[model samples]
Target: MAKETYQSLQAQIRKLQEKAETVRLKQRQPIVASILRSMQEYSITLDELKAAQAKGVSGRKRSVGTAKPAAKAPARQVAPKYRHPETGETWTGRGKPPRWLVAAEGAGATRDQFLIAQ
Candidate 1:
């Protein structure tokens, strides 16, 4: 009888633990959502957070107060392959067409007309 009761109590504890975890997750959702919203509002990036953590580990004081802005990545510049003769507007012909190119195309202009002289 004691062994049966112990087994029953163990089963109850398992059921209670499952219920507690579900409740904990339900409670945590709002907190987690608020944290995400706050991070978005402040424009906090993951790299900034990691940098701050690294600074903390290294005993840096300045970075602890404010995260240092990451160095600006070099802008990728592709030489323009197409140019408008009149306006001199240039494009690399890579991504979406610029407004001028779109307008010219809409007006029955072929892309070959805009090709820069090599």
Candidate 2:
């Protein structure tokens, strides 16, 4: 009888140990995941710093023509109208222009000229 009790107690202890280990693992999972995410963010930041340093070392040189493009003035507070001369399509400048507009302006379209009067 004593031997049987001892064996049963040992089995219970083993099950308890397993349960404790599982609980500990569950508690640690979030901390491990957060650490991995932080590491990835740090690596990204480091890569960006390296890129900025490289750009700094290479002196600014315009790939295009010698004439430096004129600096763009800040967007007007009030919405302006915009019209495409070629397409005759009109749009109210309620918000910032899309990437296509900037690319078009870079390609030599007079953006300000297209701006609709308030």
Candidate 3:
């Protein structure tokens, strides 16, 4: 009887350990995702700041010919692929632009224009 009780206790301990590990993993996943999102946001902001600085420096160059007003930087365009805004479903059909592209077109942008032009 004592041996049986010891075996049962061991099994319960093992099960508890497994449950604890699962709970720990569940708790960690959101933290990992949040960290990744923050990193991405920081990276994007850094890139934008760099681009703005470069543009400012370029604008200060002296020109000799007929001075043209600084041309607006082109928008950043992505591939002609379409992805759903909510589900991120990428469209693989023949020449079907992404949903974002469609929305931009609807907003009076030319077809194939990117959300951000450089």
Candidate 4:
């Protein structure tokens, strides 16, 4: 049998990666659905999820002679700064503006118009 060419080996690797991803997704779909259902049933907030994760990490005993740094504290959530009058949608005035705000701006509405009253 002839030795595999560089291109042929690369093709085989790509095929294997795709196959592995397919298997992974198949295995994870049920797990993801179960997690989502549980989260919705419990009305679990992201903050609670992060708190649980942090609790899990801190509860684990550190190995002898290990010197890993402590985990950073979870970020505080900011209150919304803007709200749509009609839809009652809100934004925290952080990252990129939401689509509704941008489209309203294009339609001649000023950003300040959506500012939530203090």
| Per-residue lDDT of candidate 4, residues 4-101 (tens digit) | 99999999999999999999999999999998998899998778988877677546654558778689999999999999999999999999999999
Instruction: Please report, in order, the local distance difference test score of every candidate based on alpha carbons.
Output: 0.88, 0.73, 0.66, 0.91
Worst 10 residues of 2 by lDDT: 56-65
The whole-model C-alpha lDDT of candidate 2 against the native structure comes to 0.73
lDDT of 3 by residue, 1-118 (tens): 3556888889999999999999999999999898669869777465665676667753565567989878899976645344444555554434656666677678887633332222
Better of 2 and 3 by TM-score: 3
Instruction: State the displacement of the C-alpha of residue 5, model 2, in Å, after optimal TM-score superposition.
Output: 1.6
lDDT of 4 at 69: 63
Q: lDDT by residue for model 1 over 6-111, one digit each (tens)?
A: 8888999999999999999999999999978988999987788788777775365444557785899999989999999898999999999999999999999999
Which residue pairs collide in model 1, if any? none
Candidate No. with top lDDT: 4
For model 1, what is the C-alpha lDDT against the true structure?
Answer: 0.88
Those runs of model 3 whose alpha carbons end farther than 4 Å from true positions after fitting are 1-4, 44-118
lDDT of 3 at 30: 96
